[model samples]
Target: MYRSVGLMAWKAVRALAMSMTVVSGVSGCAAVQPASRTAGAALGLDAYYTQSVGWAPCEEGKTGEWFAETLAGVECGQVRAPLDYRNVQPDGSSGAQTVLLAVARRPAAEEKTGTLLAISGGPGQTGLDLIEAAYPPEVLAHFDIVAYDPRGVGRSTPLIQCAGGLDPDLDLNADDTEALEAAERTEVAACVTDTGLDVLRHTGSDEATNDVDLLRAVLGEERINLLAYSYGTQIAAMCALRFPANYRAAILDGVVDIAERPNDMRLGQERGYQATFTRVASFCVGEYRRDGAECPLGTDPAAAEEIFQQLLRDADARPVPVRGGSPVKATDVLDASYTGLLWPSAWKPYLAALQALRHGDGTAVRRLADFQDSEGTNALTAITCTDTAGPDHRSHSQTARRRS
Candidate 1:
C-alpha cells in the first residue's frame, strides 16, 4: 500500500489494525448460510447465490502468463450472476439472462480465518491483478485472497467494448462543449452497440454488491472480509451498507466519496491533481539539488507551475512527436502527469519523462498516457455514467460556479 501522512492516513491505519485484530482473534466459525435464508431469496436470486464454483488452474492463454506467474498458487473460477437482479425468477432460473463472473483466488498458506475479497479500482480494472501484488504475507497466510472481475470487466461475460475505437487524440482542452458532448455520445453509442444496454444499465454498484454477496455464498463462507481500493471502495462501501451481515470486516483505502455527484467529483479531482503537481514540482527540485543534478522545474518551486504551463502551451502550438504513434498533445501530457502521480515509485520516472518532454521527446509521457487499456475505457465510462442518478447537463463553467 502507498504511504501517506495525515489524519486520513491515521484513520486507514487504525481501520487496518482493527481488521487484522478481528481476523487473528475470531474463532468458532459458523456454518455457511444459504443464500435463500438471506436477502437473495427475496430478490429471487437464489440460483445465482447457490451455484457451485468449479475452480481450476487458470489457462495462461486467457489470464496471460504474467498473471499466472504473479499469482503462482491461484485457482480460477466463475460464478453465475443475473444480468439484471430485478428480473430474476422465483424458482432459481434465469429470468432475463445470466453472466459469468471471472474469479481468481490464492488459498491461505496456513490456518484460514476467512475469505478476503479484494476489489480493484477503475470500475473497469480486473481484480485478478491484486491477488498477490497488493496484500501482505500475513494476509496471504491467514485468508484466501480472492478477486473477481466485476460485471462487464476483464474476462467476465458480456465484456464492455467499443466496436469503433474511441478517438484517442480527442482535443480535451477545447472549449467547445458541443464537440465534447458529441465525442462522449459517440463513445457511449459505440459501447451500447457492442455491449447491449441491458448489461450496461445494470453495471452499477448495486448490482456489483449483489454479485459480491453471491460470491460469498458460492465460496461457502458465512462472511467475507473486504479489501478495496480507489473506485472499488464504492463497491465495498455498498456491500457494507446493503449486506452488512455478509461481510466481517472491510478495509477501504483511497476512499471515494460516493455522495458527490459526477461533476462535483470531477472538480474535486482536478483540485487534488493541481495540488499533487505542485508537490511533485517541489520534490523534484529538492531531489535534484540533493543529488547535485540540474532540476528541470528550476530551483524555485513557484516557477515550476509557470514552466509546466508554458510546456502545455508549447505542446498546443506544436504537439510533441512520438516515434511511431500519434503526436502527443497537451492533453496527453496532462493525462500522463496524472497517471504518473498515482504512485511514489513512478515519480522519479515521471520527472525524467517531463524532462524529456521539455526537450521535444514525448515517448515516455505518451507511454504513460497509454497505460489504461482502451477496451476498459468503455466499461469505465458506462459504469460511471449508469451508476450516477441522472445525466449531468451542466457545462464546465456551470459546474465551477456551483462548486464555488
Candidate 2:
C-alpha cells in the first residue's frame, strides 16, 4: 500500500496485519452450530447452510499451480448462492436460482480458532487462487485462512463476460467527456443486458454479505474474523452490520466507506493519489533512485506535476505506443498512474515509466496502466455499478477530464 501526506497508509498496513495476526492469537474451537440455527436461520436458506463441503485439491482448474506449491494446505470448494437474495421462497425450500461460489481455504496446523475470511479489495477479483501466497506461514498456522470468488467471479458458476471481455479498446482519455461517458455507459449497459438483468441486478453488497454468511455456515464456525482490503472493506462492514453476532473481529484496510456511491469514494481517492504522486515525484529525484541515473524532472518537485501534466496532454493528442497492444491514450495514462499510486510495489516501475515516457517510450507507463485491469474487471464494474445507490458515478469523470 502506498501512502503520502494526505493519504492514509494505515489502511493498507492494517489489512496486512489482519492477515498476520491469526497465528499470534490463542486457538479458538468451533461450536459446530447447525446452519439452520445460525446463518441459515438468519437468511432463510434451506440446505445451503448445512451442506458439507468436500474439500478437494485445487478444484480442477480453479487454482493455479503456484498457489498449490506455495501453500501446501490450500483446498478449494464451492458454496451455493441464490441469484436473487431479496426474493426467496416462502417456505425456504427453493424459488430462486443458485450459482456456485468458488471457495479456497488453508486449514490451520494446530487447533483452529475461528476462520479468518479474507475478502479481497476488488469485488470482482478472485481470492481462491492467489490469497494463499499473500500471508506468511505463521499467519497460516493459527486459523483456517479462507477466501472465495464472489458470484460471477473466477470459476464461479455462470461467468458474466462482456462480448470481448471488457473491450480492450475502450480508451479513458477522450477529449470530450460526453463521448467517454457515453462509451463507458453503452459498454456496461450492453454487458448487463447481454448477461441478463436478473444476474446483474443481484450483485449488490447486501447480497454479497449473505454469501459471506452462507460461507460461515458451510465452515460450521461460530463467527468469522474478516480481513479485507479496498472495496472488500465495504463488504466486510456490510457483514458486520447484518450479522453482528456472527462476526468476530473485522479488520478493514484501505477502508472504503462508499455506502453512498463511487463518487463519494472517488473524491477521497483523488486526495490519496495527489499525495502519493507528490511523494513519488520527490523520490524520483532523490538518492534512492538507480545509480548513475539522472533525475528526469531537474530536481524541482513542485514543477514535476506540471511536467507530468504536459505528458498527459501530449499523450492525449498522440496516444503512446504500447508493446503488442492498443496504443495508450492520455486517458489510459491517467488511469494507469492512478492505479499505480494505489500500491507501493508499483511505484518504482511507475517512476521508471515516467522517466522513459519523457524520452518518448511509454511502454512502461502503458503497461502499468494496463496492469490496472485484472481478469475480473467486468465483474468489478458490474458489481460496483449495481451495488451502490446514487446518481451516476460517471458524472464526476466529466469534471476530471475537462481540466486543461
Candidate 3:
C-alpha cells in the first residue's frame, strides 16, 4: 500500500518537475529583489518580511556538528518571526515576542533557476540535516536548495525541553492510566516551564506554515518549489491552501492525510507497522531456508508474529537487560522496529537485531531504540498535541481498554 502511494507521489513530482523546467526555460533566471517595505507594510508584516538575513559559514557549535560535516559550503542564517502572528503589533514593535529560526541554503551549482524549500518530517527534525542527507547534485545545480528549523525545533530559539528528557522505560502495554496521565502532566509542565506556554501554544502546523511564508518573503522569491516529507506534508498542504500564490509547485512525499482524525491516523500507523513486520518475518524465514540456516522467527508467518508478541510480553514482564545501560522495554523494541522499517537499508540489520533479542542479546535493539529516541526533547509531542484540537480522552480510554 505504501509502495503504490510512493509510486504515485513520484509520478506527480516528475510531472510537476517537467512543467517547472519549461516555465523556468521560458521565463529565464533573474536576480530577485527583496520584497519592498511598502509591500510588506500592506500585510502588516513589514518587520518580519523586510528583515535582513546575514548568511555566513555555519559556526562550529552553534548550528550543530552534523551541519558542518554534511552541508559543507552551505550558508546558515537566522530569521526572527513573531511568537504569535495573530498578536503582532502591526508596526513590528517590541509588543510581540519573537523566535529566531535557523535557516540554511546551498547555492545553485549552475545558474539559479529558482528556490526550492525543503521541509523535513518529525516536526522536530532539522531541515538542514534533511537537505544534506537527501538532496542530490542535480537538484543543487538547478535551484538554490533552502531549509529551515521550524520554531521550537533544532537551532531555533526557545527550544522545547523536558527535565531529564522523556522516560525511556515507559511500558506502553501497561494499563495504569493514572500513572500515564501523571507522567504526561509532569512532562507538559516541564515543557511549559522551560519553553514558555506562549511558544508551545503557537508551535502548531498553522504557525509553522506562516513561518514558511515568512521565509519565502525573506528569500525575496515570488514563489517557491516545495519538497516535503511525512509530517511536513501537513504543513505543506496548509501552506498551499492558505497561501496559494506563494508556491509555484509542491511535491509531498510520504504524504500524510491531514483530514483524518489524529487518533485514527495513529491506529492506521500501528496496523501498517504490524503488516510490515509480518512481511519481514516471512522474508526472514524464506531467506534463512535458502541459506540452510534456521530463522529465529520460524517458518510460519502467524507463528512468527506470535513469537514477536511473546518477546514484547516478556520484555514488559521483565525488561531486556543491556550490558552498559538500562533495560529495554517493550516500547523500546516497538520504537526501534518502527524506526528501522522507515529505511530500507536498515531492514537486514533490523532482522538481525530481532534474532539477537530472541537469543537474549538486546544490545543491537537497544542501540536502534536509542537512535530513534535521540532527540531527547518533547518538541514532537508539543507540536503534535498543540495542532490536534479537542481532548483525546476517548482514544486514550479505548487504547487502555484494549491493552488491558
Candidate 4:
C-alpha cells in the first residue's frame, strides 16, 4: 500500500495489475496446484503434539520429573529470524527477531489428509491468540493446526513496541495537542531499530510470501492449505501469486485490495461507511416508527440523522468527560465510530450512543470511548507502520475530515 522505492513501486503495481486480471478473469475458480510437494515425513508426525516443546514421553518407571512437567498437550516454540530476511541463513539460528509458533494435533479424519495453516489479519494481530480461540478447528480434525506469530509482532522476540508501549489508554487521539504530538513520536521504525527502514523497505508482500513458504517448508507440509482474514488476505494472495505450487486450497475474508494505496484505501473506507449508514437508516426506519410519537428523538429518520451529524460536530469542538480524568475528543469519536461500524452487530449500540449524545448526554459517548481506549500490544503500531509507513499528521487529519 505504501511504496518505499522505485523497484517496490513497480513490483506492487505489477502485482496489482495481475490481481485485477485474476479478479476479473478467474476469481472463484479452482486453485492452481503446486509443482512439487515436500518430500519426507512431516514434523511431529511420529506422535501427536502433547507438550510445549518436543520431548520424548516419560516411561512408567522414570524418576525424571523435568520431562513430566515439560510435557503438555501440544508443542510450542520460537523461531529466531533475521530482522532482514534477504541476508538470512536457513541454518543460522541467531535472529534479531523471533517468530513464535504453537502447534496442536488432532486425530486425522479417516478420509481427510493434509495440514492446514491459519494466518490472522491486522498484519499486527496475534495469530496465536486467535488460534487459541478455536480457529482452524475444521482443519484441525483432519490436519494438524499450525499457527505462528509474525516477526515484530506478538510474543515474538525483539517485539515491536509503539510509543510508550501501545498502552491504549495513552489516548491515541488525545485532545491535548502536546499529548497527540508526543504519541506520534513512537514511529514504527524508531522503535524496532534492528529492523530499520532498510529492512522495512524490503518487507513487502514478496517477503511475506517467502516467509510463508519458509514456514511451510519447516512444517514439512507437502502442500499448505491456508485460511486467512483481513490483511491476512494480502499474505494469502501473495502466496498464491508467488508460490502457487505450494498451495493446496485457501479461504480469505475481509480482503484488502493490495493494488490500492493506503490513502485510497482510507477514501474507499469512507465510501463504505457512507453506504453502511444509508443501509442502517433503511433497516431501522421502521423500528423508529413503531416506537410511536413518544420516541426519544422522533419517528423520522431525518431527526436521528441530524443528531448523529451534530454530535460528531460537537465532539470536534469539545471533548466529553470520561473516567481516569480523560476526555473524548473528535479523534476518539472517529476511532469509536470506525471500530463499531466495522461490524453490523455493533451498529445499533453505536447508533444509540449517537442519539444519546445528540440529546446532550455524554454517557454513551464516554462508555464507548472508554472501551476504545483500552490498551493493546504494541505489535499493531509496529507491523502497520512498518508495512506502510503511514500518513503524516496533516494527511491523517485530512482522512478524518473525509470520513466525517
Q: What is the C-alpha lDDT of each candidate?
A: 0.71, 0.65, 0.69, 0.50
- lDDT score of residue 228 within candidate 2: 66
Per-residue lDDT over 61-86 for candidate 1, one digit per residue giving the tens place of the 0 to 100 score: 45554253545678888788888777
lDDT rank, highest first? 1, 3, 2, 4
Question: Once superposed on the true structure, which residue ranges of model 1 sit more than 4 Å away at CA?
Answer: 1-43, 59-68, 288-294, 389-404
Best prediction by lDDT: 1
Q: What C-alpha lDDT, on a 0 to 100 scale, does residue 93 get in candidate 1?
A: 63
Supply candidate 2's per-residue lDDT for 352. 72
All predictions: root-mean-square deviation over Cα? 5.7, 6.5, 6.4, 10.7
Error of 3 at 308 (Å): 1.7
Q: Which is the better candidate, 1 or 4, if ranked by lDDT?
A: 1
Model 4 lDDT per residue over 98-169, tens place: 343333233334335665566666655555543333333334345555566665554444444434433355
Q: Could you tell me which residue pairs clash in candidate 3?
A: none
Q: 1-404 in candidate 3: lDDT tens per residue?
A: 01112444445444443456322211222233333323322345777887889888775446554364645678888899888777776566757788898898888888777788878777676666655644445556767878788888878887877665445565555799988887778777778787777677777786788888888888878777777777887777777766655677677776667677666777876787778777777777887457775566778877987888888888778887788987777888887887677655577778778778877878888988876343434777777667764546321111110000
The TM-score-based order of candidates, best leading, equals 1, 3, 2, 4
Q: How far is candidate 4 from the true structure (C-alpha RMSD, Å)?
A: 10.7
Off by over 4 Å in 3: 1-17, 21-42, 59-61, 64-68, 164-166, 286-296, 299-302, 374-377, 389-404
Candidate 1's C-alpha lDDT? Answer: 0.71
- Candidate 2 lDDT, 163-272, residue by residue in tens: 64344666554487887777777767776676777677676566777888888878887677777666777777666666666765666656776444456667777787
- Clash totals, every prediction: 0, 3, 0, 7
lDDT of 3: 0.69
Name every residue pair that clashes in candidate 1. none
